[model samples]
Target: MPETNPQSRTGLAFGGDYNPEQWPEAVWSEDVRLMREAGVTMVSVGIFSWALLEPAPGVYEFGWLDRVLDLLHENGIRVDLGTPTVAPPAWFYREHPEALPVTADGTRHAFGSRGAICHSNTHYRAAAASITTRLATRYADHPALALWHVHNEYGVPVSACYCESCAAHFRRWLADAHGTVEALNEAWGTAFWGQHYTGFDQVDPPRATPTVGNPAQALDYRRFADATMRENFVAERDILHRLAPGVPVTTNFMTALSQCDSVDYWAWGREVDLVTNDHYLMTDGRRTHVNLAMAADLTRSVAGGAPWLLLEHSTSGVNWQPRNPAKAPGQMARNSLSHVARGSEGALFFQWRQSRRGAEKFHSSMLPHAGTDSRVWREVVELGSTIGALAPVAGTRTVADVAVLWDWHSWWAQNLQWRPSEDHDARERADTFYEALYDRHLTVDFAHPEGDLSAYPLVVVPALYLMTEAAADNLRRYVESGGTLLVSYFSGIVDEHDAVHEGP
Candidate 1:
């Protein structure tokens, strides 16, 4: 197969988020100097610099960013130009109060934290689009610009909103999807609890209720949330493509679902130029390598076996983990190469340098807070050189005799409200199966049950309770074709709407 590597054309993308804007102009030189010592090739710039990029509404400031990008370019470092639209300015909320995302409990979120805006918020989408325009117009032709990292991790915390606007949109989405109230009621199995809806207007969001809210409604809400976030992503991608036509656009995905099925990476993969992921070590040292390998394989599968990027991982312990245990010596480097082995052309971390302030102050970085003297720094330097030696592995494809089928929608709907077992742990179930194959020295590729399964000798799916009609038909055809199939306890037990299948 021809090389599918687009993002890292020059070399392996070995750098992470470079926030020179956080430091003074004086530190830009030092950061770039260290970038060389660490063998950095490409770095994502200004992921959360909205406040700096646009200090006020309708205002643009590129003076400091120009210097930062120039400094990195001078040092032979490529740039993943970030649009800085993740966190809108403080003035955004002040100017448009409706931009604030409302919590499930009916509380409007404040702007201090990242991802406080609802995906369905019109005001926020407009604001994000405006900033993306400004950034693209300014840096479209910059020599250092490589890719566009649109809005930091989507649906991180405030993925859902119970606000009236979102509720109305959700209802309309339901109407468009199911076509009619009768079809929706039947698909949702609303007859179970006298919950048949007469019209779309009668439907409200699956917000907090005095009792267990409808499972089917919640499932639809999850779909709506994913669609909403994807709309925002496409909006940004269109703007970037309009201005900087050739530049590939991407947004990082977490290893696990942070929100309730908010971002369907399998679906999102079709839209982005390349697939990328952010994986933080489990900190408990609990099969971190296996977990990382699974994440890389899944990401590669989403990229259609094309080379993907490790957008963010950790150099050492992350501050968010409870105990925050550091990785053993050489463990961190091994963790990185493991991804490269599984078809990741680029391996990067969260931040280039450890933060001196803010929420992630204790989070590890390429340059530790203790300067270049710490073990993290030494390991970072070593890993950078090691990755440089891995050019032969670049552009190579990863294949396996085994496949693990993952369905994000099924995972979300499996354990909602009530089920046969409260211990319906999909992630853990998938982990157990992966560990068994991993221990036997067998490589595996991840796939959606609905996706093509002709590449593997064995196909295994665990906790796939909610299988769609097309996926069911695909499985039937695969089995008829004589492919070996392995399934765990709760496979193929329900339709897409969390409604159980009738008698076997």
Candidate 2:
């Protein structure tokens, strides 16, 4: 595995996403000045700059980016360079409109929004690879480069595509996983609805149907979508690893259960050089702090207890919520430090400066629209100083008293069309169980269903609708070895194929 820690001059990483392209060249100097005042150490650049970097297909524009890198390096701030593959240029979309993702109901997403991509599209993959290569080759030795942020956030806004291309891709994935169509039919229990396929070409993504579709097919599609995204990440990562050898490569993960449940972090955790997460407070009436702690703990656990980065959080409130509420006076510092206490290498926000115009203009930032004299600015500076003082805590691990089992596969299965009950929410169950542990002041570490559990004296399975034979046997061994196990209702009822287990 590659080094999990980011390359930073300061022991702890700081700062947030910086989009100098959004402002004029004159404002760049002022931005750096305030960044220094706030003790900003590093900022992620070029996350959504694909359109600006390559205005036209095969036409590269590196002049502005070169200047930005030089300016940041001169100001003593490191850079988490992004590949800018999240938002392809409008021209590229016009050329290959088929690259746009299609929803299950057959609606193709427009390119105006971010993450409107079909991971199975060849044109999109080639274009993404080309830009990633260009970035790695251009700034491989840049003095300010600290880390490589592959994409903005995968499995956000959109996760799967149900287009013809995706159908073919899913068929190939199924062929690789099951070897033959006969094996797939047995695994999917296709005999029930006469859905059995005699050949791989007959399979397709679970699209809109008159009646409920096969749960097993839906579960497999989820796995295939996740793997497809991971494949793309690995492609970009390999380019960076080859061109920019020492620098780490990562894509910010939305590990919060409420934010994104598409991608499997357990699988993604192994692909990244460093595990990082983007977490926002949900104001849906539950305890926000508990959710924050749970997200942080789960992210840390994904990294196998290694120190990870708080890639993106809010300085105050967010814009996309039902009612965006500003953080209380000291809430920013408290929210940041709480992540650090759970095992984050540092804390960074969604953006260094808030947007003046755009969908996220109202989103909170380190430097708010109120300018440097505002409370957000003051809190940003204070938090920087506090983080600098806690540099000694870097590289340390957070030990947990209990382990909570979480599986994206199981979550996907439980979320299928028809289940034991529509009221049974897997995420809510996990949250409730974790909240109980939180109330007891027991630090929790999330574990995979089949992962090693001997280290944990107490292991709790909040909800796991789909369990593999290996995972079931592993739990039995854990109890046999004297470890206490607590399982909630509606667990271990189905296998990996979503088929009900016999002799239950």
Candidate 3:
């Protein structure tokens, strides 16, 4: 029953996450005025506001959010409304302490930080669903609503929770995946360690164990953990879809290899209505722009070569990094435009205004603490104008000259214990290959291992380590059909179950 195509109303989104709740009502007018001045078109709202939105169980304070959306609408700025499910209210945690995630070593994560929910916990799921339903029912018809931004960058800070609930859920998942304990045992190679299971109830998550856990078990656990979070995402996404029919729903992805290694974006890409990414420059002495290009290309590929949004990037340095040096003058504009060049609908940052207090207070923002007279603010305004001028580029696709094969499952398996070499990093291999192609001025489109590859003339597999037979056959067909294939060392060595392929 909700309105749709909010993106059609605003050509290219040009704003960042707006946390008006952090400021006083008196500052709202100034915020709107500044947004208009900077040519801001859209802002993501209510991402981490669960505590303030719902002060107590079943009680939601929607008046402030209503005013914020109304103000943005009055200024013709669109809203990417968030569900605030990432950080459950402290009261909810206090009530359901079991919802907190437990690590592999049996250490329970405290609730002071964000994204600590045990994805398998029924209470957490119910709470998340309730909040998402309430938001969808309330804001489905809001004038400024453009997109529904689901839970923030999932699989970050916390990915897998090794708790009893998760163990039970993992067993159910294994049962469904393998159909029987016999198949699971055969696939896990439990015979080697005398760890065969007769019943599904006997199995548990690959928690901390002596002499390293089973490689296949660890691999499957990663898949289970990813699927668990995905189940939660699909639940919330379906709620949004049903409540707000025409409106597109998306959760921002940290698609870069180093940012989030647990999530499989290939599977996630099929779920969201629109693909959006939050990319932060590593600034780790490597060419940051190359990494940015890689992230943008990877995100676009996840969108199936369709245009995607650069949902969140820092205006300058981030607080979490070892050396948070500020961006050089004009560097912000360059960084934003590079993404736009690689099929981003528009450029947006982590936040609109620099926070006065919080863990991310020092993270650079569109409106810095130095105010409008500062260089960051000036660059923000200039970038907004630049993006506005490039409105004609919206909905356009970026053509690629080459295809890069990437798989999160392969990365996960390679990262597990007891590999051929600890120095052989999957992400490093990917970056090296991508950087080479980028330097050669060849546009790259990343593809899933088993995805369609006929369109690409040159396909490069940087490092696979784990490859299913279907993917291997797919690559073979591509090569046989006159497509050039370049595979790196240690690729196609093991099957999806971490079992080595029988043939040489």
Candidate 4:
């Protein structure tokens, strides 16, 4: 429901991340030529261009990006211009060292990786905001600018921070959630081990405690971590919304990604103009299609059944995976159409062309380093042709008959120390429930406990470790209204505060 029509496309809306900046300017013309041959429509640009965009504090270089956008537009290719705030320039860390994230053990993460900065860091926020102002205002009227992809996967290298600033932010968020210290004490069950808090500042993140940390406190920290990531997203999204009034904004989501548990997509989905996701075929062979479907269905649910973007997938084997098995013939097309079958209107990959250098050089792309003569490139062109034949799918939405209850809170609470079973995973349990429906050839939507449930004939809830009173009542009402509720093994064991449920 939040999506607007995928703004201004070139062809069949089939393209991926294109980095002409990585190559010589002479090769830029060749890349455009290849795009036209492959029927490429739109491409995401500037995600990792922070250093290139801003070489120093308050110093920006937009001339290079200007030429790239012009070249793409001239060749009938639209752009999903990224805000380039994913990785802060090295100069930012040198200027504001406090922006780096602190680990659970109370050590700051190094500055080499993409997401070294903390979500709650004030300095980082100010700098990122400035970059957004410049980019958004500068390209507001650009014909090539179609969609906005906010920062790449949040909680990528590190999810939460144990810094002083984050701790202060956590206390404020807690104060808002639970008004009084007495209420907080009762909710957190502060009496468990004489860990009562006289004031919110007395609380710290779940560190290496005397033993297993306080379940309630740990749960709140998880909520805080997720909130911090959500804050970063909202910060950038609000700017984009204000500057580019009509352009739909998106941030690629990774549903099965372990590092992504800290980001509550159900909550994050509300903030985005369009829902989008990135999925790579796992170590498993073509069987990875099942996960592809799961990711797509979950993304569809987040979009409220509206069309979402398939932001990034591998054309073949991914370099990061231990076993990088290229997809057999026809599997890539099947994998793409499967997402389309769910709700993705546009089909895309990680990179348009293979990287000639860097970490991802071995990773598959639409145009392989082997050139257009290779199987990878041949399929890329054919896939575009196939997508062009299915233009009607762009307007149609995937219909769901079943709903799967998805909650980040439950996921966090279930993983707390001293649980009934260590093997219990809320997400995997939800996936199993989905797989059963999938096996039966039934379409499903991953519904938030508080989201709309009236559309479903049958609703499946998996291992709901933590449940709110409102959510419980909503599920009850759904059943009373003639909806079939199928619950998994570990359901409704705790309250929202990670306290054991006491039935009346």
Tell me the TM-score of each prediction against the true structure.
0.96, 0.98, 0.98, 0.96
* Model 3 pairs whose backbones collide: none
> Which pairs, if any, clash in model 1?
none
- lDDT digits (tens) for residues 383-406 of candidate 2: 999998899999999889999999
Give me candidate 2's TM-score against the actual structure.
0.98
Q: Predict model 3's lDDT versus the native.
A: 0.92
Each model's lDDT comes to 0.84, 0.92, 0.92, 0.84
lDDT order, best first, reads: 2, 3, 4, 1
lDDT of 3 by residue, 263-290 (tens): 9998999999899999998968999999
TM-score for candidate 3, please give it.
0.98
- Predicted candidate 4 versus true structure: per-residue lDDT over 65-125, tens digit per residue: 9999888877778889998888899989998999998988888887887778788889999
**Model 2 lDDT vs. the true structure?**
0.92
Output the better candidate (1/3) by TM-score: 3
TM-score of structure candidate 4? 0.96
Error of 4 at 128 (Å): 0.2
Cα displacement (Å) at residue 83, model 3? 0.1
